[model samples]
Target: MNKVVVKKIEDKEIVWFKNSNSYLVLEPIAAAILLKINKNNSLEEIKTWAFKKITAPKKVVKKFIEDIFLLYTVNNTLKKEVQNNSGTYKIPTKYYSEKYYSIHNCIFKIQFQTGFHLLKIHPIFAHLETESQNKFHFNYTIFDDKDFIVFFKNDAFIGKWNKNETHLFEGKLSMHLIIDIYKKPETDWMGVFHASAISNKKESLLFLGDSGNGKSTSLALLNANGFDCIADDFVPIDNKKNMYTYPAAMSIKKKSLKTLLPVYPELKNAVEYHFKKMNKTVRYLPPKNINYHLKLKCKALVFIKYNIEVELEINSISKIDAFQQLIPDSWISPLEKNVSVFLEWFLELPCYQLTYSNNLKMIETVTKIFNNDL
Candidate 1:
C-alpha cells in the first residue's frame, strides 16, 4: 500500500500511488517519462526528456508537469469529516434485541432494531458476550431501515448498507471496533487488508488472494490443528506494524465443507447462510485459540490457493504484482505517518505464493514459514 507500483498491461502501464491509493493509466512512453521524473529535475530537464522521449512540445509541458505530474503522487490530507453520509436513515421506533461485547479492553453496547439485524452481528461475538450493561465505551444502534440498514456510533451517523449488504455492514462495524479498542482514531491505523492472518505466538503471516483462494479455510484448518488465528477477512495493522487479533468468527465456505468437517465436526450441525453478491454459502466457525491480547509482528505475506490435484508449490513473488492485487482489496491509511510506516514495512518482508492440494504439506509449509525454515 505504500509503493508506486507500476504494472504493464498489453501496452498501458498502471501507475499506482501508495500515498493516496489512487492510480493513473498511461501509455508506456508517458509512464516511463513520468516515472523517471525526479523532484529535483529542473523543468528544462523534463522538457528535454519529453522532447527526446514522447516528442511532445515543451511549450505547455509546464502546465502538464505542474498539474499532472504533481498529482501523480498525490498525498491526500486527512479529512476532518471522515464519515460522509451517502444517505440518512433515522433511528427506529424500537429495538428488540441487544448485546454487549468486550474486545481487547473496549466494551460496546449494540442494540439491534430487529432479530434480522441482530443475526448479522451477534453470531461473530457470541463468545465475547457480556452481561447486560447500560453503560459502555461505545453505543451502537443498528436500524432495520427498509431497503437499507443504518448504523449509529454514539449517536453520530456511521453509515448505511443496502439489505443485501449485511456482510459489508458487519465488516465496517468490526473496523469501527478496531479503532475503538486500540483507543486511536481511524487515521492512526496503518492499514486493513481483506486477508486472513495466522500466528505462531512470535510472528504472523498474512494470507491474501481473490475470493475462492481458500484463505479463510486455511486459517480454519491451521487454527484447528496448530496455529492461532489472529484475524480473518478484515485484518488490520497499526503504525508499529503489529497485527492485532480480530475476534469475529471465520466464515467456512461450502466448497471447503468436506475438507474441514473431519477437523471441526461441529460444522455438520452449524447453520449455513448464503451471500448472493459473493456467490458463497458459508458457515461461521467461532474463532478458536485467539489470544485477544495478542499482537504479532508480520513475518511475511503469502498469496495462497488450493487445487484438488495439484502438488504443493511455494515461491517468492514480485512486490509490484502483489501490491497491485492487494491495494484494490485493502484499506491502507492515507495519513503520511501510516503511509511511511507501510512503505518501510512492506519493503522488508518477503512475499510468497503458496499453492497446495495436500493439507499435510500445506501445514508443514506454513510452520516452516513461521520458523523461518522456508
Candidate 2:
C-alpha cells in the first residue's frame, strides 16, 4: 500500500505493480484491490470493497489483503534501473573485441563486428576489458557476432537477434556470455558446477542437486545462520579445487516462499518471474552484500535430496560416487588434458548425501558437518 504503483498495459492480461525494489504481477482481482490501496483506506474498508467487487468470501478477500501487505512491507528491495543512452555516442561498424576474466578467473574474449549501434556490448561485460587492454588473451574467441559468423566458439551455436527486440536479445546474449565464461576452453584450471555454495569465511561447503532440488533453499538457510552464500544455482571451482563465489542473484522458486519468507523478509519484494516451460514461478533474491569473499577452499560437498515424507538423514558416500554425480551437471574446461587430477582433488574433501524434510534440521546437520561434529 505504501510507495507502490500499479499500471495496466494495453494488451497484457496481468496488471503490473512497482514495489520498492521490484515489479509484482497481479491477477485481475488482486489488481482491483491493489489499485484501490491508499493511505486513507483502512484494512476493513479495502476488505469490504474487495469482497463486494469479487463476490468472494470474506476469508479469501482477507487472504488477498494479507498477501499484498506482505509485499508492501518489504524494505530495501533490489531494483533494476534502465538507462537510455541511445544516439549519444558514435556507432562503430568494424570489428571490436574485448577480453576479461570473471571473479573466479574464467577467461573470455568476445568479438563484435556490427554496423548497428543498437547492440551495445552486453551490460554485464561493459566493465570488462578488450583483448588489447589485457595482458593475457584467450586463444579462441568465446563469442563471435560478426556478419558472417555469429556463434559461440566451443559450441558453434549462433543466436538470432532483431533490432525491435533489443532488450530480449541483450538478455539472451548476457546468458550466453555467462555460459561461455563458465565453460571456456582456455581456463583449464576452472570449472563450473551445478551446485550451491556457502561459507563461514574460513571454509566453504557445496550442495549439489538437480534443479528444484532445494539448493537455493539450503543456501538461503545457511545465509540466515551466520554463513555467507558464495553462489546459488551455479558455482565455480578453481584449480586448487576451491569453490568461488559468483555473485549473481539467487533464484528462489515459489514453493520455497513460505520457508524463506521468515528468514529473508526482503524476499517478499523480490522480482517474480514465470517459467512457462517449467510451469513454475520463481523470484530472484539479491545477495546480502555485492562485495563477497571471492575465493573459498571447499571444506565438504553434500548431495542434497528433498524428501517431504522423511526427517533429516545424513550418510557418508564414496568419493567415486560423488565424482560421477557431479560430472553430469558440471561444465569443465575442454583443454584440461587429464580429468583425473581434478577428480582426485575434489574427492579429498568430505562428501555426504543429505536427505531431509525439515529445513531447520538440515541447516543444523550442515553446521555440524562443517564443525566436524557429525
Candidate 3:
C-alpha cells in the first residue's frame, strides 16, 4: 500500500515521506491520487476516487501509478513492502532475488524476478551494463565477448549479466568489482572519485584520498572512536542536488584493530571475515547521539594520507582544487543538473587535509580541530 499521508511542507506543496526517509513532494492532484491509494483504500476504491476527483484522463492516473511502481522498484525499498502485499496482488507484482559474491570490501547484489527483469539496487554502484542504454543512443544488449552479457531499458539495465561462477542477486554487490567498474570507460564518462564523508548536525566532512591512502581505515578509526559515519565508501548525491548518506553495518579492515579495540570493547571477541568478503569483523555500536534523519550541511573537505608516526598534522587546502577532487567520488554523476546544485553546496564548504599516524594521535587531532575550529 502507498504511504499517502500527505502533509503541507510549505504553502505551495505537499510532501510524502517513506519509511526509508526517501520522499516525494506532489502537487494537489498528485497528492490526491496518492491519498486515494493509501492503505485504507482498496484498489477499486482508488480507481473510483481517481475517476471522480481527477480531471486528468484515466491514462494519466495509470501512468502516474506505473511510474511510481517503477521508481519503487529501482529504489529497492519496495521489496519488503511488496513481499507483504503478495496475497493482495493489489497492484501488478514482481518477485526479486539476490545472491552475494566475494572479492574484498566490494559487494554486489544482482536482482531478478520471473516477469520483467527489473533490477532493484542499493545506490552505492555505478551501472556498467547501463552504459549501452543511454537515451541518445540506446543499445538493448551489452556483451563482453562470449563470456558475459547484460540487457537494458533507457540507461538502466533491466536484465542480467552472467559469467562463470559469478552470479548477481539482492545483497551488497562486490564492492571490489563495483570499484573496478567505476574505472572502466563507462565510469570514465560517468565519473567516480575517492572521498569519504561524515555528518553531524547539518554539516558533513568529505575525506578525499587516492586508493590505499587509508580513507576507509581512517573512517573505521573515526567510527570506532566517536565520529558518526555518513558513508564508508561512497555518498550518493542525487540529481536533484540533495545529498543523502547511506550507512552500512560493517567494519573496515585496517593494519591495526588494536587502535579501535579500546574504544569499542565488544570488538575484542568479534568474529573475523564474518560474512561475504568483508575482511575485518567489528560489532556495530550505536552512535551515541545520532539518528538516521540527522542531516548535516557539508562543512569540510579533508584530504587524508596515512602515516605510521605518533603525530598529526592538519592544514587548509584550496576549495577550488578540493572541489575538483571531491565531486568525482560522489556516487551519483555530479554533471547532472541537480549535481551542479550539490556542487554549489560543496564549494561553500571548508576544506583541509589531515596527515596522521596512530589512532590516539588521529583522535586527538580531530578532537582539537572540532573543538577549536570546526
Model 1: residues >4 Å from true position, as ranges? 1-20, 23-45, 52-90, 114-116, 144-148, 161-169
| TM-score of candidate 3 on Cα atoms, chains taken together | 0.47
Q: Model 3 clash tally?
A: 24
Compose the digit string of candidate 3's lDDT tens values, residues 31-125: 65555544445656666766787678898876776565444345335346312222322211233533332212233333343212332232222
lDDT tens per residue, model 2, 1-374: 34444443222212223333233445666656655564556778887777778766778778879887655555225466644232332333345544454433655555554423312443323333334535432322322333222333433443444445554444444445444545533344456777888887888888998888889888888888888888776676666575655666677899899999998898797657665656878777755543334567888889998889979999998755676587666655433222333545564778899999998899889889889899
Which candidate, 2 or 3, would have the higher TM-score against the true structure? 2
lDDT of each: 0.80, 0.61, 0.47
Report the Cα lDDT for candidate 1: 0.80
- C-alpha RMSD for every candidate: 5.0, 20.2, 18.4
| Candidate rank order under TM-score | 1, 2, 3
The residue ranges of model 3 lying beyond 4 angstroms of the native Cα positions read 1-146, 149-194, 239-242, 265-271, 274-290, 332-336, 368-374
Choose the strongest candidate by lDDT. 1
lDDT at residue 169 of model 1 (Cα atoms): 86
Which regions in candidate 2 have their CA more than 4 angstroms from the true location?
Answer: 1-185, 290-293
On lDDT, the stronger of 2 and 3 is 2
Q: Distance (Å) between predicted and true CA of 58, model 1?
A: 9.4
Tell me the tens digit of each residue's lDDT in model 1 across 1-374. Answer: 33455556435666656545665556686666555553445667777777665545666665666665566545333325445463555676678888988877777899998877787788767778998876789999998666888889888888888888777888788889888887767877898999999988889999999889899899998998878999888898988898998888898889899999999999999888875666878888988887867778999999999987788999998876676677778877756566667767776889999999999899999999988898
How does model 3 fare in lDDT?
Answer: 0.47
